[model samples]
Target: MLTTLLYSPQDNSLIQGDDSHIAQWQQSDDAILWLNIDGELTEPLQAMLKQTFNLHQLALQDASRDRHPPKIEDFGDHTFILLRGLSADSESINCDNILLAMFISERFIITRHSARSLSIERTMAALHAGDISLATGTGALSLKISRFVVKRYHKILFDLETRLEQLESVMLTTADDKVLAEVVLYKTDLTRLRRNFHYHVELFNNLRDEPSLPFDSALAHEINDVCEHQHRAASLADLFYQVASDLIDGYISISAHRLNNIMKVLTIITAIFVPLTFIAGIYGMNFEYIPELKNPYGYFIVWGVMLCITAVLIWLFRRRKWI
Candidate 1:
């Protein structure tokens, strides 16, 4: 769907409209037009962007395709920026990041996204509530949106930090396969979040240096701030991954230690019984010349011998602290 918000600087008021009024507002010389498209761009919407906004066909294709990395393309008259906003819910580790495509110039701004974006929603709400004044130029508005996207990354980073903490806490007291699996998952998701921001860090730096658009010092500073935050988020992700990797190694080490202890106990028991088994095998020999078999207390004698050997082995093991 298409949502339009027109900001007239004279009255400092926003005029909201639908697709029907897009053409009328697209040509307005006095107002700054904001066109937002949610979901895949249909033919008509594509045609509108092409004819009205003069958006490049290549940029449109990139916006519609999957797995387009965050980037900025300088189209001379207008700049096309592609950004990915991370989702905060760690539970949905497999969910894809939200893709946002923006076209900005002095006169208008167009934002397109494939999926629902909380940051975009918040930006739009702020604009509609008149919380953001039109005086902050289109570049600052773009920066505001980028900042919101970075804020989402911060939320995911916080979640990652919390998850690693929980894993570390439980790792010592309760190490298990489930906990290890969770650590691995956290690392994977953290890595994904880092990768998303890594691209933005570069993209924003290049955007700030774009020669075609004269970015004000304030706007440039905000872009730099966004880049710094992205770098921070990426660094946090790496740290979390390392912690999680350590947790996995620790869990494995503990498991191996327990298994070794169990095996050691079993070996000690077998060692204690080996000598007794040897004596019993001798007594069971069917030789007619066996003198012990002829004795009346031979069975008792064998039992006494076996008990003595078992006691001696147990005592020896205890002395050596092996049991």
Candidate 2:
């Protein structure tokens, strides 16, 4: 789907419409043409974008596939940027890669996205809320949007750290695979976030040097701080994996010890019964040669012998500390 929003600086009016009717918004000095695209865009729409905005063919191709890494590029005529957005839910974490093509000139600003992202939308909201104003130009809006990306990276790290602590507590009492699964997921989420955040950090750092798109001096300081945050988050993720590996080793050692104890008990019981069963089997053999069949006290004598053997076996096992 393609929808347009025209922000008119004249009356602080917002206009919503399709392609043809949005041009009337050009009358305002602070007018912006915002195009939001969701899901799979059709061929005609792609062609329209290419013809209307003169988007590079290669950049359009990159937008079609979702795994593109986050970065920004200035093509002299327009700027092409790819960013990662949080695609999390109550169940599992997912990452959404969005392509934002910004066409900035003296008269207007046009932002095109291949998919919807909360990060982008929130920046738009901030722009509405006066965090960014039209007098500051499109450069201010771009910096605010990148700042949102940096903020979300911190959130991902915070959440991962919390889950790891919970997993560590679970490991102390019970050996479980669920905690491991959670660790695996958290690791993956952090890795994705770190890589994406790093790319943008580099992008912004490079932008800081370019005088044409001079970012606010205050935000320039934030670029370095955001880079440091990404580094810390990535380091913590590696530490979690190391801790998880050690826990797994401890669980295996415990399992082996329990098995050994069980085996020792079984061995002692089997040894005690073997001789007794042999004696009973011999006395019960075919009657032709059996003298116990004639003796009246024979049954009691055999019972006494079996009891003595059982007591001796138990005593031996206890003395050897095999129980």
Candidate 3:
């Protein structure tokens, strides 16, 4: 679907859809125009965007793809940028990439994105509510997008931290392999996201405070907030990775210790029984000359000796604390 919100200076009125609406918005001086393209563009839609904006071929390709992490391109007439907005619980949320392009002219401004993410949606609503106090022109749109993206990141960051903590708690208590595997799974997901966000760190820092980026003073503040959000997310992801590593190490160490203990007990039992087995074998031999075989009472003596030997071995084992 195609959606457009136009703030026209001619009548100080809001116009809101497609090519004709955009053309009307474009004619108005000192107005902000937002174009939201929700899905894959059909041939006609592509043709419209191409003819209307003269978008670079590479920019269109990047927009067509699932998501472009974060990058800025200089297209001479305009600067095209792809900003990645992360969703909560990627296991449940789609990793949809949002492309926000800027057409900065002296009087009119235009922004475009492939999807209506929380970032753009929230901004559109604010702008529609006629709360000029929020922001104005392209600068205001940039501010809203930045604020919304960062705010979403904050919520997701909380979730990420919670998952990390819960996994650590489970590892400390039960140390179940399944729980560990889950931790590894989430950690790996975070790893991929971290790489993506790391790219944003560079891209946003470069984007931030770019006086030439058409951000007004108020919008610059919003950009700063965005930078802070990216910083916090990156830091939390790094910490989560470290925590998962520690958990794996702890699990392995405890398992190894338990195995060692079992082996030690078994070895001590075997050592204690070796001599008794030898003594019993020697007497069991069918020899007519054996001393214990001739005497009727020899049986009791042999039994007593065996009992005494077993008791002594048990005592020694207890003394050594090897049992």
Q: Top model by lDDT, which number?
A: 1
User: Global lDDT for candidate 1?
Assistant: 0.79
Model 2, TM vs. native: 0.66
lDDT of 1 by residue, 58-93 (tens): 898888865788988888778888998754342343
Q: Order of candidates by TM-score, top first? A: 1, 3, 2
Judged by TM-score relative to the true structure, which candidate is superior, 1 or 2? Answer: 1
Candidate 1 residue pairs in clash (backbone atoms < 3 Å): none
Error of 2 at 38 (Å): 4.3
What is the C-alpha local distance difference test score of each model? 0.79, 0.63, 0.66
- Lowest summed lDDT window (length 10), candidate 3: 87-96
- Candidate 3 global TM-score: 0.82
**How would you encode candidate 2's per-residue C-alpha lDDT over 1-323 as one tens digit per residue?**
66666666667665667775445644445576666565565567668667866667777666655667766666666666566555433222344555554544433455555556566678667756766665555555665565565566556556656766677777667767776566666556656655665666566556656523323465566455655654555565556556656666665676677778888878887898899999989987887978777899999999999999999989988898877
Error of 1 at 91 (Å): 6.7
List where candidate 3 sits over 4 angstroms from the true fold.
42-44, 87-116, 130-135, 209-211, 216-218, 286-289, 294-323
What lDDT tens digits, residue by residue, belong to model 3 across residues 1-323? 67776666666777776656777755755666667776665667666666776766667677666655677765655556666764323322124345554444333444555555666666767777765422255655665676677567556657767876787677666748898787677667667767867876786687674644455465567667778887877887777778777877887887788879999888877876787788889988988799778899988887788788878988988898877
